[model samples]
Target chain A: MNIRPLGDRVVIKKLEAQEKTKSGIVLPTQAKEQPQMAEVVAVGPGGLVEGKEVKMEVEVGNKVIFAKYAGTEVKYDGIEYTILKQNDILAIVE
Target chain B: MNIRPLGDRVVIKKLEAQEKTKSGIVLPTQAKEQPQMAEVVAVGPGGLVEGKEVKMEVEVGNKVIFAKYAGTEVKYDGIEYTILKQNDILAIVE
Candidate 1:
């Protein structure tokens, strides 16, 4: 029931796109853009990847901004998640 | 001027697509398919990239097969080449 990414990969749950305006007006579904923000669900055990030594920097529950159009989309238990390599992540959000 | 790729990257010159038939007939330009094979032109210094320790594996003059649509196409001194990360190279042709 859980996904364990392998070798420098990470499993992330995308933060829901903001659908409400600053004035609390709800925007339509078509107006909601896919957010690049996500919470790290799992971190891969970093070791030898493509002959390189990789060390995982991000930890579980950390918010991050990832590259657009990167990673694979997967559905588990009716929940959508993205699995991507650590390099695809641009920055960790505080 | 020659291009020198940066860290963990490689510059490769794509091999010319076969333009002749086995029967010694010359095929039209439109019939030529892009070849995936290339000769390594320059290799980046092996070092820290994306927080990982990457070691350069391929060397200059080595023929390698790279992933399709990988790397950035660049023209230098009237010649075309591709600059891509080392991971984008799939295998070295013996």
Candidate 2:
């Protein structure tokens, strides 16, 4: 990707929603909601945001869990992605 | 009135929705949505919030405009109020 996010924003690729449950029951796509987990694709520089100094916490390629309905969806080169503030990310998934 | 907000949170009383439009037409209360304007009832002492330095901007009795659906609604002593971060406030009305 040739794009770089600015100031506390992060670019992420959403992980695919689970298709099967623990009991091995396959679920229809509509039955599942958008996944909360994602892989960090790009990281913005840690700096001031809205008069507040924000330090970027997550790194590129890290798996993360983010708040629901927190990011803007975008499609680039047919690949869907999300752009959200660092604050919207709740935790890094091991 | 005994509540004191912490961090950058502010306590506010929502203004009543307009009963009539400028065209001299009276509208039912149900036809109007929650008002975006509010009177500042109490202000939090701003310092550091979520690892960021925040400065208190609004004062008590200041009429301000805030983002729609931004605050938590609370009922205290039969008076309704909203508690939200100062960042949710859009502008101070004259």
Candidate 3:
């Protein structure tokens, strides 16, 4: 199933959070940092907002970083995804 | 003192929460919805992100709605402000 985003929103597939620390000790779910990396799956049309034109920056295949706890999380077809505005995207990963 | 947002970041002054509901019954702080309306005080320069030019949509002095729990709160110079990226803003109100 497709989760088409509206406006400047985009659908992203989150990267798995690290289960362990750098020291190789396993950490509990609540103790680990929330996952921030994601792969952009779909992008919505970004246009004029408040008399200013807002442009879309990331492409569908780009890997990006999102603000922690930014958007609604949903599970679709057994895959977890997040729908967020493009502004929630912090950075693009090469 | 100035809170100059950097890299598409913005400084906003949150609007006061309504103490009473539409039904005219006064509500306590915990019973009210989180305050989301904000006035844009300062805006960061919208620039290239991930090799694409990301233009800013809202201008200074515009009233906007932000996602719940989207920014870092601070009390500066006797006033409260929230520092968040442009994406955290949900809409601009006329």
Q: TM for chain B in all models?
A: 0.79, 0.80, 0.75
Please, what is the TM-score per model? 0.45, 0.45, 0.45
Q: Write the per-residue lDDT of candidate 2 for residues A62-82, one digit (tens) a residue.
A: 978776567555444556666
From the highest TM-score down, the ranking of the candidates is 3, 1, 2
- Give the alpha carbon lDDT tens digit for every residue of B1-94 in model 2: 7889999899999776451222122222231232266789999997878878777767998866555578899999999999999877644544
Q: What share of the true interface contacts does candidate 3 keep?
A: 0.00
DockQ computed for model 2 against the true two-chain complex using alpha carbons: 0.03
Give one clash count per candidate, in the order shown: 0, 0, 1
Which has the better DockQ: candidate 1, or candidate 3? 1
Better of 2 and 3 by lDDT: 2
Clashing pairs in 3: A87-B87
Ranking by lDDT: 1, 2, 3
Q: What is candidate 1's lDDT per residue for A33-92, written digit by digit as tens?
A: 222667899999988888877767779988665554689999999898999998776445
The candidate that achieves the highest lDDT relative to the unseen native structure: 1
lDDT tens digits, residue span B1-94, model 3: 3778877778998765451222122212341223256788998887865555556777888866565578899999889899998877755544
For each candidate, the alpha-carbon lDDT, in order, equals 0.69, 0.68, 0.67
For model 1, the stretches where C-alpha displacement exceeds 4 angstroms are A19-35, B1-47, B50-94
Deviating ranges (above 4 Å) for candidate 3 = A1-45, A48-94, B19-35, B50-52
